[model samples]
Target: MTGEYLAGRGAYILGLITKRIWFRASLFSVAAILTALVAGWVAPFIPYELSLTVGGKAVDNILTILASSMLAVTTFALSASVGAYGSATSTVTPRATQLLVDDRFTQNALSTFVGTFLFSIVGIIALTTGLYGPEGRVVLFFATIVIVAVIAITLLRWIQHLSSFGRVRDTIERVETVARRAMQAWAEAPHLGAQPPVAIPTGLLSVYPADTGYVAHIDVAGLARIAERYGLTVHIAELPGAFVYPERPLAHVSEAVDDKARMAIKNTFSILPDRRFDQDPRFGLIVLSEIASRALSPAVNDPGTAIRVLGAGHRTLADFVDTKRGAKACIHLRVHAPALTIDDMFNDFFRPIARDGASVVEVQLRLCATLSSLAAHAPDIFGKIARRHADAAKMRADDALSFEGDRAALHMSDF
Candidate 1:
């Protein structure tokens, strides 16, 4: 399989798993129970016998308290998490909620809490059933102490995480981070290591998707293998982030193929309900723009957030361009995929901000400055696009700002 194909598949699976709370929690809970069971089984084999001052009743009382308190904590945590998710969805863009849902610290903290609670419950039941002898009780007591320590640390961190979990600023940072990774991946393998076809071959047979959805991933390796096996040249019409329907062609084969080969080609394309950032950097850019647009809305009127997002977008794009210099070459494939264009990137990320933040002087000025900086560092085409955006933003500023001085300050000459 091609590296891009494997990376896409891995990202798809990891994305699905990390977004769900139960998967990590269940794994932790099982580990907790298993650890307790294993400790109990080995307790009697200890070589040293010691006089333990702690009594069974005392241990029982401690376990009882832990179990009850943990139940309360878990319930509270669940409620708080729900509220955070709801608040994030209502206040910020709903697209950002996915990042909050998949937060590692929050997931780890909750899973740790739930697992420790299960550990205590299992330990208590084992102690009460006479399954553990005196030595086993001693082991369980020590284990309980360790569990308490763990719970204390987790609780402290969870408190810290909750402080900014669903806040707009935190959500934006999370989105930026995901966007950066996606951009870097795209920069490294612009065409999934396949050379772009010179042009669409004449008389190519078109292959369409069976259903309508966003193109989540493309199995380039599999496509290449199929092309090589069938002695055909395949041209991918849709990139990973493109939405495809029954009427749209997914790919174009140089020659007509049997139903089985057509089905094989179709299977290489993964269609999902929503676009993901890992394979589709454009989705990330779109999300960042959405946040900026939301911030610029009359209801929110948060220009600072919009400005910060602009800076973030600038940095991400700059890095994407800078990294291209050192990007590793990919193995050639029989299939060819189209490269993402700078114009599309700008449209996805900056156009909305420019349109929505037209009235805000600070936002307009920042956009011009950012675009100018990008233009300075980018190729001729990038510079041209940047100038286009800067000029458009200035027009909006002139119309929106009442003061001539304000409009003059935002003049294109400054950029």
Candidate 2:
């Protein structure tokens, strides 16, 4: 039980760290400082013959130049990043801004630039203070060269990244990638290592959340352990990514638990102001749909982008259904969780597109084709869900499309 709690806590902390750009930048900055310090300390132990005949003034000049240039570079990069974020929020879905902010390539490039700047500043201070001997200057000079190389590489990569940073296509791809990963994880463990949820027994006590927010993550392992300790069967009422209010029950325990146990169970759920895609596959799907809907809006009227997003959504659902084949259920948990249905996933991704793109014959035809493909490949339950959406989309197309030929062309053979 303790292990489960710690594991859950660790994962949450890691998620928090990854989400913040500064955490990684701070780590790299510290590493840069330590590298300089260690190299200076070790310099004297090396033989004088191996030391380069670099002058103090020369090393000082290089360090000064690096320090000043890096400062400007850091500022420019920060401004560019801010611009990218703002553009993304305004042009793309605002929810996608978080992903852009947390992007690994962009963050790493910025961190490298900032870390190099700090390294040079420290080296300059140490040099001016006469903290390093002749041998130390050699180490500092070599380190300076390496840092310059790193800075150049990072600058080049940052330039390339800027080209598409926060663009709609890039944001959609990022969201799709994240959503696909989440779907893979869920498909692998759809019940979250618990039996399929059943009706709460008549005597079981319902536990409500003290605060209201989206249920970001559920510590299923912790919940299972808590259920085991209390000799109770627990049924979760809310899934990760679900929004909860004070009145809604979070879970039901087979027997009444005391205040302490109730608190522990509540702790198993992590509530936050917004949903994340790492744990919530549905959130990713919704984000993709948002991007498509934005493109299909009258102001944008970009049916091509909407069509591309439909393909992405179709591919994601296809992968999800394919992964579920021959999958085994988790048998070891004491807590039960509700399973997400194909109908829900279909609605989450395609409903908005169907509504927003009703007037665009191209988008409507593409949506119906995607749905037909999914229906053909999906199992019986999922095929029905896909056909239902196809029919609904066709009805919407018939009502909104100006010409009967366009509406007739939107029909799916399977539907």
Candidate 3:
């Protein structure tokens, strides 16, 4: 049965839209323009004496200065942001750049800068056209004061944000935060609130992917609705973050699937060129592991970074295990999707670091320790997988570590 997903298609789409920089910027611009126009409406409510106290010339000068300065500030901000993106790509991993791009603090700062610029421009235009009489000018002046204050505070915060904006720790924190969120969401709605799919029944109809790419999102609720309406069982063959080809099955329908049904089913699975972090827990783990791998690379040779990321990965997994997800809340009884395997997560989160940092004793020690700790997290589930990785890491250390002391040190560690 294709049951409802915790997040519907609209929510999934909205999640993507909100991550965009321009969306927030466009909203801020529109709001600024509205604010400029609203002064005329507010003008009537202000007393004539208040208008007399407000100087049109001073308001005009402030707007002029604000407009000119904001243009320069916005340009600098863009350049800084672009530089940070480049830095994150080179020092961290290209995969992490998207997170930085979607950073709310940076986005809001840029939006404020752009919005304030537009607000100033509109206010100046209104002033020049005499759209704001003395009363209107008073309202506009007060608005300008508020804008200036906001800009001042924003500038200070932005300056502080830029200090570690694209640094390695910052990027890793960003990845860790997202990875935790994904894990938490998964914990809340295990298997997307669907039954763990069993072996396909003999006569199940297969739905193939139309394109070759990663499954970015799956509209689970849509499938449930379609399945319920059509009176069929829909077993989701792939989860978000899965790579798919034309030959691969996206889902299996229990009844005969018509052209309309096939298309509808396919639409529920959004395939994109790259995997996204949202709705994809494993992708976050993979990206975090990738960061550790990059840090372990000979070009960078930054083991400290890899070590820090291990801590993040450990914390992310530990949080998932520790979360009080009492029972499997299966909401979408109609949709059957596979549950995430701990082994795969262990591989995704730690295998690469173990492989790449095999030579470093500190890396191996940290890796083995984290694995043993994870094994202790849920002995039945994580114990075996954690031991598997720990054994692999120990084996790698045996080959890579020249001194017996180093080998013995790793062998002696227990959780």
Highest lDDT: give the candidate number.
3
In model 1, the runs with Cα more than 4 Å from the true position are: 1-11, 51-54, 325-328, 379-381
lDDT of candidate 2 at residue 56, scale 0 to 100: 50
Alpha-carbon deviation at 316 in model 3, angstroms: 1.7
TM-score of every candidate: 0.93, 0.94, 0.96
lDDT string for model 3 (51-156, tens) is: 7777657698899999999999999999999999999999899999998899899999999999999999999888888898889988888898999999999999
Residues 299-354 of candidate 1 have per-residue lDDT tens digits of 99999999989988987888678766223334546778888788899999989998
Which scores better on TM-score, 1 or 3?
3
Global lDDT of model 1: 0.81
Tens digits of per-residue lDDT for model 2 on 1-415?
1121123745876777766998999999999998777767988786686564465565778778888888888899989989989987877799999988988888888888888888888887787788888788888788888888888888898899999988888888888888887777777666665678777678778889988899888888788889889898889998888999889989999888899999999988888889977667788889889989989888988998999899888878876766652233464367888987777888899999999999998888888888888877865756777778888988888889988788777763445
